[model samples]
Target: MSAPGPSESGSTTRRGAAFADIRRRQQATRGRGRRTRSLFGMMRPYRGRIAILLVALLVATAASLAPAPLAAKAVDDGLSKGNLDHLTVLVAVLLGVSLVGLVATVVRDRLVGWLGARLLSDLRERIFRHLLQMPVSYHERQRAGVLVSRMTNDVDALQTMISSSLVTLISSVLMLLGSIVILISLDLKLALITFTTIPVLLLGSLAFRLASVDAFARTRETIGAITAHLQETLSGVRVIRSYGREQGHLDRFHELGDENRRANMKTVYLNAAYFPAVEYLSTAAIVIVLLVGGAEAIDGAVTIGVLIGFVTALDNFFGPITELSNVYTTFQSGMAALEKIGALLDQESTLTDPAHPRELPDPLRGELRFEHVTFGYGVPSRGGSASAGGTGASSSPIVLHDIDLTIPAGATVALVGSTGAGKSTLVKLAARFIDPSEGRVLLDGVDLRDLRQRELRSRMGIVPQEGFLFSGTVAENIAFGRDGATREDVERVVASLGAGDVLDQLPQGLDTEVGERGGSLSAGQRQLVAFARALIAGAPANGDGRLGGPSILLLDEATANVDLRTERRIEEALELLLSDRTAIVIAHRLSTIRSADLIAVVEHGRICEAGTHEELLVRGGAYAKLHEDWQRGTTDAPSAAAS
Candidate 1:
């Protein structure tokens, strides 16, 4: 056929480019067989049901094939011979076969559909479980929309293969084999003539299969891209509207939509060409059969009944051939999806719990020590080699260098720093989010790494800068860490934290629903809720003394965003919470850190000065300068109390 018209030609060009990109990605995917095998292995648990479905398919194909031969016999013996009894018998048999085929098909389809849905559910659950186990870094790099698509679109593709393609492929093969054997038995010469077009049919199918792989891959990828774009745009819709970028975003969306449209059209074109080409080849086979059989019949080499049987079988053969070609496409799409999913499953976590981790001693005391700690955050070496820099040195040259510091149990240490001063990094080391590159973080004189991570973290309460909450009621958000807490338990924690007024202010009090990420609540409210959650979690679960209160409290910009009144209430609450806990508070506002027992002024990832709030003012150093700046910003005259 001639190439599509000019408008169509332009579309084809765009589609071709899209397909090329998809092909490049497919080529880059490693371990095709491993992925395919793993996907198949998932179905092994349901093998018995699959086998029953296959048996039903075979029976359906056989019953379907039976009617064709019976009709051919009726054509020659009843119509040509004018025999009524033979015609009636053959008609009845054909009707019975059709009924049997219908029943078998329905049973097979229902069974396979159930199997596919069950397998898909299992696969989704498995993936979700793995996702939960994955570290925070994995989520940091992945797009929400793309991950959602993998669970939905990719799994649905495999579902189609299992529900339809699996049975269809088996039945088609059986039907084709039955037709070929019967046709040759009826007339070898005509069968040979039909066989001549097999090579053409095979070549056309191979070409279509090869081209379709790229086309389908493009279609899948474009869908993911469009999904990701929509997710990102919708999440930031408020910003987009505020900045008057709606029209710009709409234009970009249209561009992505056009790309998706072109990809689908390409797949359509390939499918359109493939089916017609196969039909033409089948028609060619039929024409050859007719020419060779007609001559043989006239020369008295074959009977009319046998010739009719050959022609009838040819019709049956083409149906399976066409179906098989379609199944090939489904197989390829499923295989490609499996490969992507398997790669994700095969990835090993970079950080895992150690084997035989040391147990924590009873009645844990909060004596935190940093012993000659030198660390770098992930930084490139001068020679350009990539290094997993320790938390201390990762962000800049070194947040902490040769730092040896010890905090006595129940001491309040405040970390005061400007931006990029590594105050956050220092606290993260104590939390064990990342280990030190050199030296060690010791908790009660034991190496932090030697203790179980879960055991160590359980004794700590953190009020992060941005208080994150899940989709639930305000009460649930507060009681998140402690299990099986009663309503009274929740109310007590809220009252103690001075957040009871926050509950009363809400429309539904503690029962009010917090929208996703606590979007419904104000920033101050969210922070208070997080503080309540930490306090409740730190409290002993059972009256048994096994689990103690939080031995360490790490606050990073905890009150930075709260109002002055809320900050004061939080400070009052903190006085009670910090009485028996070792507290490390990271703050930018000098006012918040002024009452700290000891304040360390961090600059260039190092502590430039450290002393009590009053003594730091007397030192005439970085802390003194910062204190003077704070006084000037707050008051016209520096009061004696400030010194």
Candidate 2:
């Protein structure tokens, strides 16, 4: 049989694509429904308060309904009969109704406000906790700003819905229901006449909902993009300015802003046309009521008092329709936000602790091992061309593969390798930040996966090349390493590490502000602070005599960013810190790690050579060649500083 022509295949492909799109949309709809249900389920715990809130809303709405009827009585009974006392009574009754409404409104607002605040706090905490629980690979694949927007913009939208717009929507609904019942009871004909305009309002609302659903979602996405771009730009502003690309970044920002403005303007355009159209329709309905009621009164079918009452009741009916339209934008924005937040909450941490985790041995030996470990970030490690992270199209690019290595207790093992040689990946595996796809990483002769992550990590101290610090004083940053670490503890930790230069150089000594991420401190200063922090980890458990820190110290090119002078000081600090601790150091300078007990030379995700520094030099293999090059001032290891 002959193969089908291109046009025929194209048509078939298009049909399949269309079907897939429809299925995806259906799945999304179901997911949104589930998320909405879950959201409501979360609120079930506050059901009692919600019940009270509903009662208050209903009472306020009922009180608002009383004014129109009272006015009618004042006109028909008091004025028509010229009874001054009756009019005064009606006026007083109206004032009392107003007071009731005011009180109900206060109660409803307070409850809604409290609920919104509590829920927002809970949701933000949940998102942050979830993000923290996620694997390192998950973070590697996501933009920081996008994750930040989940807690900020998304939660804010839902907060507004709960605090204000939702209350308005509910109260308006009650108003509509109450107004229609009163109108029908007083004069069925006029009620039916007003009800005739209902279909028109419904049709308009339906159109608006359909047109604005995607628009509101797009606005949420555009704002997220804006946030991501702003964050990225700020983070790399130094590079941009150095490259004289300030105008380029500004132009990019303007592009993002334009996209956000365009998305928002879509809703603005819809509201401009839709809400005003609603107002116009309600006005037309009121005019119709007045015209018909006036004629009925003139013909003596209805009294002027009834006519006035009907007109006043018409405001209650139409006003709600107008109010609902006003809040539609907020409702739509909130629902769109809910969809994004729900998706984030649905993301489960890929690495879960064992159901019954093994506890680390007291005074952990900190012996580390990687057995046949194979891993890749968000890609198949076995083999198949991955688009990202570099590889031949027909081959898989694994970050670490079939690796076996061991560090005996209290031994310093330095990892010497070129860029992308799986040096950092090994450290992450040891830390259980990301699990290996194929083999096992063990600490204290037990599989790392069998132990609780916090328990496993509590005994290991990791210091990256660039020391990251929080926005706080140096003492607080140091105290972050240990719970309840007082100023004395900080001083002791610092003194133990022999990093007096770190504090002595600071303007406020230990109390010096590090600024955001220690930006105010020099690179060397940050590293010193980081080392002190690492040394304080297990101090409390040891009665504060020895540093009693993590038994394992993982230093990933920790000295690569500093100058020779700082490196010497850091080396001096490490000499003291490394005593009786299993040290895994990823070093760029061969001279620094000369005393390392074991040196492993890694190349292209595999360990090509392992031995003492002098032994590797004697072998004259990959490590020897790297050492020769390094001695000649050609250090390739620190160029990129690991993957």
Candidate 3:
């Protein structure tokens, strides 16, 4: 081709951009179609009730439409002809129609309410199950408030649509269509005149739709933001009050609330101007038809009864329109909510159980091995020498590099390093909380991925920095670690952990409620309970203290916050806890891990030293440096922090 001018180049570029935009829009449309199908597919199980609802709607609409014709018959065939008997018959038929309509409406409401409740329940369960299934990395990047919003605010929008707007939409369409046929059949001329206002209605709706294109979606978004803010505030109220930042948090919450209010107001503004105008137009159509029909009657071209019937039937046309207008808010919000919920449902977890999961070997040794593994959160990482940020296709820094290590069965391996040195990442790999990006983690001889997550988790127990307890008795919280664990089982596990004082300290012993997140108890108490919870799962079946349920125990060093006395008590419990179990502890204090079977010095996603603490001290490498720093800092040795 000859050298093209800048104008030609610009034009070609514009065309290409335009085509790309078209493709994006097409893709979005297809996505929405799929989401819509998924939303309705949730209702498939209740199709039988749906059929009954449909029948009720039809019956109700038919009964509702019968009245106008009956009035016309009474006027033309009964009143005008002076037949009282005929008028009486029409009146009785009218009463019968009202009764049928009443019954149908009741059935419709009952079924709609039932479906609304069922769908809302199912939607929450789906979101919750999927959310729990997601890998630790996915949760690490997402806000708790946003996920809570999906389960609460987004799902509630659909509830409003089901209970209110759904029936209106169906009934209005049927009524509108039914009215048109009756009006045309009654008086074609008058029906055509009444139809003249439809263009105005359509034009108004088009304008409203254009103005409110993304308004409903914006409303949903703002509400979710508000919910997120509120949730965070409530969760951190103690911190806020402690820091004297309650006013600041209140200001932030108000800002979010205002944003939500503004978003909702946009839709309100559109409806305020649009729906009333429709009502006025409906009234105008009535005036036009009545004026024309009166003249026709005076000219003897139409009967008075037909004129009356046309006016009464006029509502059938505008009534559905008004009903739809009334429920438009619910419709739009529900659709917006459906899209959000669908996106959540579409989140495919990388940590799902295998299609054909391998059975866990009986007498599992829990020998953990990481073989040349690599990992990233699929999350953008902060820059520096540590993260190796902007790596590969992900553009997110790798948190773990090619690593090979083995923790033999029934060994206590203490992970020691700096804050971002992939200490927690290693234990997480061993637990299979996340899959390795490049290589595999094996339990015994089998890849972790091959084992079902539930079975794997049941065999292993993790106790983090905070031992989060549910709102229940201390015994109940301990019982959660194992299935069908009785009150006796709970008491025995506590006694075995040497944590009997925790129950004695409680007013009701094991029956005393933990309160939300174990808030009713002290930090040390919570930690002791957590230890018991972990051990109760496959605890010593006999008095000999042999491992039963949980063979692998992951501890994040729960004694860091307590006093020396409590710390010593926890250390005593840890001794018993670590017996015959494969243990990986993220050691915060260097002194605690000196006696560990193995100590791995991790630095910037690589283990620089592996051996006993004494071996590393003799070698005089990275671990020696950490030990030196800890000795200088304090006797507690928190300066040797990991993760």
Which window of ten consecutive residues has the lowest lDDT sum in model 2? 382-391
Local lDDT at 367 for model 1: 87
Stretches of candidate 1 off by over 4 Å are: 1-30, 72-99, 369-408, 435-456, 539-549, 601-611, 628-643
lDDT tens digits by residue: candidate 2, 1-643: 9998999999999999999988987987898799789878878889999999999999999998987788778888999889999999999989999999999999998999998998888888878898888776677778888888877898999899878888999999999999999899779999999999999899999999989988999998988887888888888887998999999989988998999999999999999999888888888888888898899989999877778888898899989888899888998899899999998888766677889898888868888988899877654322232212222243545788699998999999999889889999888888888777677888888998799988777777788888789999998998888777778778877887667865787888888899877888988788878877877776463664656777888989888887676677778767877878899999888777988989998888998889998898899899999888887664454633431
| C-alpha lDDT of candidate 3 relative to the true structure | 0.83
Estimated TM-score for each candidate:
0.84, 0.91, 0.92
Candidate structures ordered by TM-score, highest first: 3, 2, 1
Q: lDDT for model 2, on a 0 to 1 scale?
A: 0.84
Q: How much is 500 displaced in model 2, in angstroms? A: 2.1
Please give, for residues 371-432, the per-residue lDDT of candidate 3 as tens digits: 99887865322211111111235576678999999999999999999999998888787887
Model 2 bad stretches (over 4 Å): 1-21, 73-78, 81-92, 379-396, 486-489, 492-496, 539-544, 634-643
Candidate 1 has a TM-score of 0.84
lDDT values, one for every candidate: 0.78, 0.84, 0.83
Clashes of 3: 2
Model 3: residues >4 Å from true position, as ranges? Answer: 1-28, 379-393, 543-549, 635-643
Give the winner by TM-score: 1 or 3: 3
